[model samples]
Target: MSSQASLRPAVVLSLVLVVWALTGLTHAQPKASVLDFSASLGNLLPSLSRPANSSRIFYGVMFDAGSTGTRIHVYTFIQKDPEELPVLDNEMFHSIKPGLSAYADMPEMGGYTVRQLLKVAKKTVPRLEWKRTPLVLKATAGLRLLPSEKSQALLEQVQDVFDESPFFVPDDSVSIMNGTNEGILAWVTVNFLTGHLYAETRETVGILDLGGGSTQITFLPKSKKTIGSSPDDYIARIDMFNSTYELYTHRTCIKYLLCHVIHRPPYIIVLLYTPGLEWRVFKSSCLPKKFREEWSFGGLTYIVSGKPDGESYVGYKLCYQEVLKVVKDIVHQPYELKDTSVFYAFSYYFDRAVDAGLIDRTQGGMLEVRDFKKRAKEVCNKMSKYRPINPFLCMDMTYITCLLKDGFGFKENTVLQLTKKVNNVETSWALGATFNHFQNLKIHR
Candidate 1:
C-alpha cells in the first residue's frame, strides 16, 4: 500500500510484513527488521503521542497500476495489544479501467486516473490523518511492457498527481513492480491471511496466480533439492516469522517462436517474458477452428487463431503438445510438489474454472489436477459450445492443464484450493504489496 523506504526489493520483506501486521513479533525479530520508526498502539505513526487507553489505528493507501485497470486499496489497521501484531480492520477498494499505460501519449489523462482514485483515500482516511496515511503506486505488466521513454513520461505525470494529493508520498512511490517481487507478494498475501505464517507446525500453501499479462507460482519447498535444482534467479531465500524459507517462484511470458511468429499475451499458458520484443503475427492451435482475428493488447497488435480448418485435428492432445513447448525448460519442477504441497490458485485460474462450470462462480471450491484435465478435454473438443462465450476458453483451459501438469510437474491428483479472497480481502498482491511498502521493512535482498 504505502511505504516510506526505498531499498532493494526482498522476498523476505513481503512475507514478513503481513506477519508483523497480523501477529506482533512473538518470535525472533526478522533478519530484515523494521525501520527506525517508533512503534505505538495509535492513530498516525512515528512518535505521535496518544491516550494510553485509546487503541492504535493506522491508515494506508496503495494504487495498483496494472495492465487492465488501475485499482486503489485503502487499508485500516488496528492494534489493541502492544505485544501482538496489528489486525487488518477494514479495506476500501476502487478501480478504473484502461490502465495508465493507455495514456502514454497523453500523460495528464493517466494522471487524472490516479487523481480520481485519490478521492477514495480522501474520503476513507480521516481529515486529520491525511498527512500520515502513506500513498504509493506500483505499475505491473502494463507499464513495464511500454517503451522506457513513454513509461517514464507516464510515471512523471503520476508523480505530479501524488505531489498534489494530501496523503503521505514516500520516496519511489510510483514505479513499475518487477515480476519477481510480484510473485513473492502474492505468496505473502495468501499465506499470511490463511494463518500459515503463525502456525507452530509451520505449514504454508503455495500460490498460483494467472493474469492476462503474467502468471506466478510460489511455494516454500520442503526438500533442499527443490532449491538446489532451481535456477538461482528462481530461488529466493526469505527470512519470515522467525524462520528462513527458500522459495521457488516463477513468472512466465511468451517469447518463444510458435509457428514462426509469437502469440504474445503480456501473458498465457500465463507469464512475463523477455523485454524489447518485436511485434509479430502469431499462429497457434490454441484457438477454435472457426476463430481467427487481429487482437490488440498492451499497445501491440497480434494476429491469433486456431489451426486453419482441415489443416489439423484440434483437441486437448494437439493443444497440449502445442502449449507444452513454451514452458519445457522455462518452468522448473519442484520436488514432491504433488504429495508435499497444498496450493491455492487464483486470477485467470479461478475465472477460467468458473467459466467452464468446473467450479461455482460465487463460491470457489476445491479441485484436483484431474478436474482441470477433464474440463479441458470437454472444452477443447466441444469448441462450438464454448467458443461463443470465449474463444480463448479452450486455449486458456488447455494452457492451465498443461502448465499445472508439465510446467510445475504436479501429479494428476494434486489438490488445489482456489479462492478469490481470504476473509474479505482480495487474494492478490495488492494487500501484500500494501504491507510490503506500508511497513518500512528494508530487508537485505
Candidate 2:
C-alpha cells in the first residue's frame, strides 16, 4: 500500500535493479537454464535510452517473470553507432527456475541480489563480460495475479538488482501488446516468406494474435512505390515499402474460467486428438435457444465433452445430452430444462475403446470441415437479422487500443483476427546492438 512517491527518487531507482536481482535469485541453477535468440537492434536503441551522448555503451534487458520461472533478454548498443544505427553484434536469452519461496522472503531487493542475477547470467554466457551494462526487468500476468503486497514486495526486491530501476511493470496489458505486436510481425514475416503478398499484392495486412491470457489484432498499412519504366523497377521498389503499425486491439482476461473454476491457482486444460469417427461426428453444436436467453451472452454454447484418464483425455463419446445439460445449468442455474440444448452432436475423435454412439448422424445433421464455414455464415446472418449488434465486442479490450492508438497509429473500423503461437527461442540482436553502445557508461547518482 506504500506510495512510490513517498520514496526518494534515488531510493526508488536503486530498488529497481535490486528487485531485479532478487527475482534473479529465484533462478536457482541445475533446475534452471537460459536461452538467447538474436535480432537486429539498430532501430530499437532510441526507445531504450537517450542517444545524445557520443560516449557510453547502452545495454537493455527484457525480462518475462512468470509463476513457474523467469526469462531474461540482454541487448547491447555500441558507442560507434551514436545516432543512425544498424547491425547489432550479439544477443542473449535465457530461462531460469528461480525458486518461488526465495522471492517471498525479501522485504526489498538490494545490490547483493543484482550481483547474483549477473553471476547467473554470466555463467550462462561464459565468454561474455558485462561491465556497466544497464539492465531493465519486467514481470508478467503471473506476478500481477498474486497478492498486491507480495507483488509489490517482489518488484521492490527485483529493483534492488539493477543500477537503475526497471522502466515498467510487465502487466498483462504490456504482455498482450507485446504478443500482439510480435504476432503482427510474425504474420508479416510468415506471409512474406510464403509469397502471399508479393510485388503485385500491395494491400495492407492485418494480424491477429491470441495468447494464453490475451488477444491482440493489429493493422499495418504499407505503400508500394513505382520507379523507372523498366518492368523490373517495380520489383526493386516493392520490398522498399513504407510501413507502420497502424491499429491493434489487446484483450486480456478479466474474469476467466481459472478464477471461476477450481481455484487451485492455475487452470489447466489437456487437449487430446482422438481420431476414430468422421470429421462430421466430431463437430461442435450450438446451445439451445432458451439456454442462450438464460445466460448473459446470446451466443450459443458449443461443448465437446471428454473424460480425463490421468493426464490425458481419453475414451469419450460426444454427449449432446450431457453437454446441453452443462450449458443449461450454466444458463438457468437451478432451473431444470424440459427440452435439451443438444440439437446436434458428433462422434469424431472419440476413443474407440469407450465409444458409445449417441446421436444418429443421418437423422440429425453433423458438422464437417467443409460445411462448417457455411453453417457459421448462416449463423452469422441469422444473428445479424435478430440482434443487429454483436454484444461480445463490448467485453473485449477496447481501452488498450485507445492507449496505443496515438503511440502506434492504430485505426478504427477494421476487423482483425487474433492468434497466439509459442516461439521456442529466438534472440533479438537489437538488445545487444543497443546495449553495447552504452555498456561502459557509468551510472551517476
Candidate 3:
C-alpha cells in the first residue's frame, strides 16, 4: 500500500509534466499551424487552450489562517460549465501544533512549515503557468491580528520561493472580501437548492459568513439588474453581488478569545459548506475568557451569565445583573462601545421572569417567533443606536439568523438547519480540506 501510494503521486506528477511538455510544444508551433495541429491533437487540445477545461485544471491554494493553525486547501477547477463551478483533486494541508504566527518559539505543526509551504507548492506544481494561472494567498483573522512586521515577514518568505511570482498577494482586507464572496456564493447556492432564484432583478441580498475565527454580515440594498449568460456565469453572478465579511479572532470562540486577549483577529470569516446539514459560528468578542480552554456549552453558558439552576436550551437563564456585569467588563476594553442606546437583546424560545417584561418594546424590538428577517432589522436598528466602536459582534443562533435574514436580507426560503441537528453535516473540516477532489475552480484575466 505504501509503495502503491508513492507510485500514485509519481504517476500523477508524470502526467502533469507531460501536459507541460505538450503545452510548450503547442506554443512553440506557429500561430497559423494551430488549426492543423488541432486535427492531430484532437479533442484533448480543445481543452488545452482553455485551462478551465484542460486536463491540467486550474489549481488554487487556499490557506484559512486561524489563530491556532492554518488550514490549507490545494484543489483544481474541474467543472465544464460556468454555471457549475466544481472542485477537483482537492487536498487540505494542516499545521495544527504551531499557529500561523511567524514566531520561532512555537512548535512546528507540520513537516512543511509556513515558510516551506511556498517552496513545496512551487516544486509540487512544477509547470504551474503562474502568468496564466496565478496563486492566491489570502489571510483571514490570523493575518489581521499579526503585527505588521510578522505578517510582512511571512509574505516575504512565501514570495521568495516563486520563480514567476503570483500576480496577487492580497492582505487581510482582500481575504475578508473573498470570505464575504464565499458566503454570498454559499447563500446563492442554498437559494438554488431551494429552487428560489432571484425574485427580482434588483433584489436585496444579505450574506452572513461564520468562520473559524470571525463572522461577517454583508447587507446590500436593491441594485441594478445584471445577468451572467457566459460560460463563467456563476462567478459572474457572484461578482455582481456585493459582500462584507465580519472578522472575528479565529475559527472557534475559544481561539477568538485567545487571539482577542493578545489583541489579534482572524483573517476572514468562512462558512464551512458540507453535504448534509450546515452549521455556522458567530464572532463573539463577548465569549467568556473561560472558553480559552476546551469549549463546552456549559463553559460558554457560565461565562455569558452566572450559573443556572436549570437547563434552558437557548443560552443560560437570564441573570440581568450577572449578564450586565460581564457586558460591562467587556465594554471597558480599549475600543469604546459605540451606541449606548442600542440595547443588548437576548432571544429565547420561552420567556423567563427576568427577560419577559424587561425587553423594551418602546426603545427596541424583542423577538420571540422564528421570523428571522424581522428580528434582524430590529437588532441592527437597535444596535445602531449603541454606536458600537468595535467591529466584533456577539450573537447566538437567534441573533445570527436575524442578522442573516435582516442584515443581509437573504431570501426567506434560504435553507436553515436546526442547531441541535448540526452534526448531520457528514463532511468534517479535515475531509473537505484534505481529500475532497470534486470542487470546481476558475481563473480570469
Candidate 4:
C-alpha cells in the first residue's frame, strides 16, 4: 500500500508540470505573431524595407555636339529601389572645340573626334560598368545646318565609333535634335537640377538658350492668352514622371531674322534662309557706326559692317527698332511674365552676360531686363571705343535686350538668372536627355 501511494504522487507531479508548460507556450504565441506582423509592416514602407546602400549605382555617357564645340558628360546615378527615380550623384565633363560640323566633309575626322572623347568616358566611368553605361551623341544646330547627306554621313561615322566602343549603345543613339525638343530638354535639365521638378510647391522656371545657328525660348504658360495667342506649332505637351506639362517653345535666329523678303504685308513674310560667307559684307544697325570686321559663325565667315555707305546708326533706339522687326509679331507674349515666373538664360545668353560684365564668369548672377538695356545703350554709344574689346558687343547686347523686352515681352524689372551650371552640372539638355533615355529603357530598375 505504501509503494502505491508513492507512485501516485510522482504521477500527479508530472501531469502538473505538463499543464504548466502548455499554458506558457499558448500565451507566448500572440507575442510571436505580433513580432512577425510588425516586421512585415516595416517592409511595406520603402524607407524601412531597404537601406540606401542597397540601391544600385550606375553610370551614363552623353555627348553634346553643339555648333561651337563638342562636349562629353559622364554621369553617375543611384537608385534607392526598383520603383524610385535614379538620383544624379556626380558628373564628369570635358569638351573639344570646332564641333563635329567642322568635319562634315571628312566623316572619318568626325569619328576620330568622338573616338577621342570616348577615351575620356572610358577613363571616367568604372570599367566594370562599361557595358551597362549607355553612350549617346546628340548633334544640335551645327549638324541641322549641314546638308542632309552630309549630316547623315557624320552621324553614321559616329555610330560606327559607338559600335566599336565598349559602352552600351541604343538604336537611335546618334541623331540631330529638333530645335523644339532641344528647348524642352534644356528646360527639364534646369528645373530638375534646381530641385523644382520634385518640390511640393511645384515651382518651375523658364529657359532661354541662344546657340550659333538658332535660339530658343521655353516656359510653362500660366495665362490662357499665351496659349490662345500662340500658334499651333508653338505649344507642345510633354508627359514625364507621371505628369503632363504644357510648354511654349519658339525658335529663331538670335537677334536677326534670316532670309530675303518674299512679300510685305502687315508683317514681312520671308522663308528662313541660311546666309554664307560668299556674300562678303553683312550690314546691321546694331553694329557700331564705324565698325567693320570679319566674323565667323556656323563654319562660315562674313565681313560684317555697320553700313556700306557711311557710319551706321548705333543707338539703343535705332537698334531696338531693327531687332523688334525680328520678333515683334512672331513671338507670343506671356501675360503672367509681368509679375510671376523666373527665367534661367544660358548658352549664348550666359556667355553674353559674362562678356558684358553683367555677371561673373564662374559665379553667375541675376539681372533685370532693364540691366541688359542699360548695358546695350552704354556699349552701343561707346562702340567706337569698345570695338577693339569685342566688335559684336553692341549688337549682342542690344539684341538680348530687344529679344527680352520686345520679342518675348517681359517687364523691364523682370529678373533673369544667368548661369552656365547649377550645382556642378552644366545646365544643358544632355542630362535631361540622359534621364529620358534610361527611363525609356527602364534601366533604373
Best by lDDT: 1
Tens-digit lDDT track for model 2 on 1-445?
0001111111101112222222332311211111111111222233325556543334455554544456565543343333433222233555566522236656354224444455544543323224323344545445555577776676666654543332211111122112222333344433332233343554444333322333333322232211121123111111111222232223233223221111121111101112233432222222112112221111332232223222122111122222222222121111111111111111111110011122232233222222322332343223323223331111111212221222123233222221111121121212212222222111111
TM-score-wise, the better of 2 and 4 is: 4
Q: lDDT tens digits, residues 1-445, model 3?
A: 0000011111111122233334443332211221232222222222434545333345445554544555444434333432232323333343343455534223232223554555444544445433333344444455566567666665554444332354222222123223333334334333322222334443332323343333433222222221122122222222211222221111123222432312222211211111131233322222222222222331342112211232221131221222232223121111111111111122121111122232343233333224443443333233333223312122232334433333323345543332110111111122222111111111121
**Residue 120 of candidate 4: its Cα lDDT?**
84
Candidate 1 Cα lDDT to native: 0.70
Q: Across residues 270-382, which tens digit of lDDT does each residue of candidate 1 receive?
A: 32133332454555566777687876654666666666766366878887886776657666677768776679998778888898888897788899989999988888888
Candidate 3 regions off by >4 Å? 1-56, 79-97, 102-112, 115-133, 163-207, 211-214, 218-445
Q: What TM-score, over all chains together, does every model reach?
A: 0.81, 0.37, 0.39, 0.77
Clash number for candidate 3: 36
| lDDT of each residue in 1-445, candidate 4, tens digit only | 0000011111100111222222332221111221222222111123424665576556778999987678998876655553454456777788888789889999999999889889888987788877656788999877887889999999999999998888767667888987778888888888877777666666789998765435578888877787787777888877655456787887765334331111111011111121342465656666666666675443556666674355445666776676666656655666566766689998768888898999999799999899999999998777777777877777678877877887678899988999877776778998777756644311110
Using lDDT as the yardstick, the better of models 3 and 4 is 4
Task: For each candidate in the order shown, give its overall lDDT on alpha carbons.
Answer: 0.70, 0.29, 0.30, 0.68
Query: For model 4, where is the 10-residue window of minimal lDDT?
Result: 1-10
Better of 2 and 3 by lDDT: 3
Judge candidate 4 at residue 143 and give its lDDT.
89
